[model samples]
Target: MDVKEGNELKEFNMLYKEVDELYHRIALEIGLSDSAFFILYSIVEFGDGCLQKDIADHYFISRKTINSSIKNLESNGLIELKKGKRRDMHIYLTQAGQKFVEEKMMPVFELENGVFEEFTGEECRQLIQLTKKYVMLCREKIKETYHLSSEDL
Candidate 1:
């Protein structure tokens, strides 16, 4: 790449790391581990009765990490697991979980919504479009470089 292109790539990577660090900071502020925060966040987003596999797939987190976090949450009585039809477990928030989410998770949602409120609708659309395109291209490049198939992803 030319100098300008290389500089742009560096900037992009820096911005990506900054965004990740911001999430880590938010998790710390909320007194939760990164895995736990993401687990709870996914549950809230996907609604009750979401599956462990769904959370792992949606968030690109490892199944081991997801399983560990689910166990922790279960022990705390913040979530419960029930058997689904096909031997998979469905996760649900307990009464305490509902209150916990209302107290802890709601503020994070409000903060995220507030930030989006500052952006124009067109800007938000562009941001999502560009991000998705970048992710697709990145995945393709990784696959090509490693000779990986879609299933590997």
Candidate 2:
């Protein structure tokens, strides 16, 4: 890797960390733990039939972490688990959860949406495309190093 490549990686990592920190602060301000907020956001975004394994894969976190988050959200009455068509446990947001998101999360997203104020729609799309590609590349590298199948992680 060249100096430019190293710098780009560093910048991307810094941005990722900054965004995570911002999420933590906003989650706390809205009376939720960071993990609970992320879990609730995923449930709301995915709507019904979202499985625990799906959330774990989506966040690249452990099932244990997701279980903890789900427990917290359920205890708060922000979400519930139901049996899916396949008899799997699925996560769904409750009415109170939807109301809270409307009154709280949407505003937070609206404020954070300013991050792309200087970019055109196409630019934002391109960034997301490139980021997804990078994520796949990283996954491949991990699989190679661990000699594991996609299902293993």
**Winning candidate number (lDDT):** 1
| Candidate 1 lDDT by residue in tens digits, 1-153 | 646645778988999999889889988887777888888898899999999999999989998999998999899999999999887999999999899888999888999999999999999999999999999998999999999999998
**Which regions of candidate 2 fall more than 4 Å away from where they truly are?**
1-6, 85-87, 112-118
Residue pairs with backbone atoms closer than 3 Å in model 2 (clashes): none
Q: Worst lDDT window (10 residues) for model 2?
A: 1-10
How do the predictions measure up, each by TM-score?
A: 0.92, 0.77
Give the number of the best model, judged by TM-score: 1
Residue pairs in collision within model 1: none
Predicted candidate 2 versus true structure: per-residue lDDT over 1-153, tens digit per residue:
646645778888899999899888989999988777877777666766588888787877788888898888889888889987775789887889889888988887677588787789999999999999998999899999999999875
Runs with alpha carbons beyond 4 Å of true place in candidate 1: 1-5
> How far in Å is the alpha carbon of 4 misplaced in model 1?
7.7
Clashes of each: 0, 0
Estimate every model's Cα lDDT from 0 to 1: 0.90, 0.83
